[model samples]
Target: MSDRQKGLIDALQLVVPQVELRFCARHMHVNFKQKWSGKSFKDVMWKACRAYIKFVFDEAMKEIKDMDESAFNYLMAVDPSHWSRHAFREATKLDCLLNNMCESFNKIILQAKDIPILTTKYIRRLLMKRFLVKQESISQFEGRLVP
Candidate 1:
């Protein structure tokens, strides 16, 4: 582990409820490689990721173990080096709420930074517009029907 991660773990050790250190899913998929691609493997990997999203990390691990014990054990043993589940779980609790916020902030900065600087009113209007659109889209996105 780097000095940064070690320091983070040390800080987390002091906090109650523990910390979840998650490896980003997109980051892992780009790094790990397989000898021969197979539909079953992809399905299993996605299933494991979806399980984590369900907010039941242990259940996800159990699913992975049932699918392939050896692979799951390998992943658990060297998790941060190979998987995102442990990292995500460690960073998910109350103390780490800024993770997602930081991502969203970064995205907004990246998109808006290049635009001409705006006054406070303009920024507020922009935010309100985005909020309304997002609120409108939520129901559609939440539904599971084909549209």
Candidate 2:
């Protein structure tokens, strides 16, 4: 959710009103650093984002306000639910701050599409070998779980 473009954000919100929208903490940190630079600020920002309790999040925010009122205000302007763990919906059960996994999967899919025939052949062989190995190892497992 780092797009930051008003139209894009609005469009996404409108399209998927039921989905919980969140900004990447890493991208927010980079943007924040560009405007204000300090290791302590970054640490406090991360602390606030990672806080799972309201009290802890408030404490971290208090520290930020004490250090820089403007910075605190800037953060306050952004919706807490979009970045803070304490404000996140527990129902979603998502603890991730970035979309790296989705991005990686998208890249893989795009690559496969660009090199369809070769990639299909390679992927088929890879999956066959992987499944065969897993199938062989499955019989040796002593527990109900694969591991």
Candidate 3:
């Protein structure tokens, strides 16, 4: 494996030790689509990717317990930084794995990149409007859903 791939594996082992090393299925699907163009395949791939992310944590823990006895034993000694689904909790020391926080910032930049130079001002205004709308949507949704 390349240094970059090895580093990712190492990081995963350190952060989420009880999970099997699984590549992000979203990224794998994008790569597969780039290699072979097929809309039908893309749709199915996306469905599988969603399912994988939704359920993989439990499956991974099981696999880790079964496949690597020594590693599993070591991991059991390390406490996971428990993250509650709807509560604000600080990440434990092991939670340094660069995750969606970086991706969300990159996504914002990518979304703004296509703005025409002449229309940059207009694009910024539009972006602000869209952001406010999204903020309000979230506030409303959370207000309804959260206590």
Best candidate (score: lDDT): 2
Task: Check candidate 1 and list the clashing pairs.
Answer: 19-90, 20-89, 20-90, 20-91, 21-87, 21-88, 21-90, 21-91, 22-87, 22-88
lDDT of 3 by residue, 1-147 (tens): 111244776787799786533344344445556644476555544333333243544444444456445434543343222221111123322322223554664576675677668457766786798899988877776455654
Candidate 2, residue 6: how far the Cα is off, in Å:
4.7
Off by over 4 Å in 3: 1-6, 14-16, 19-22, 52-100, 105-147
Sorted by TM-score, highest first, which candidate order results? Answer: 2, 1, 3
The predicted structure with the larger TM-score, 1 or 2, is 2
List of clashing residue pairs for candidate 3? none
Instruction: Give RMSD to native, each candidate.
Output: 8.9, 4.6, 11.6
Q: TM-score of the candidate numbered 2?
A: 0.73
* Worst 10-residue lDDT window, candidate 3: 80-89
TM-score of each: 0.36, 0.73, 0.32
Task: Quote the RMSD, in angstroms, for model 2.
Answer: 4.6
lDDT of 3: 0.46
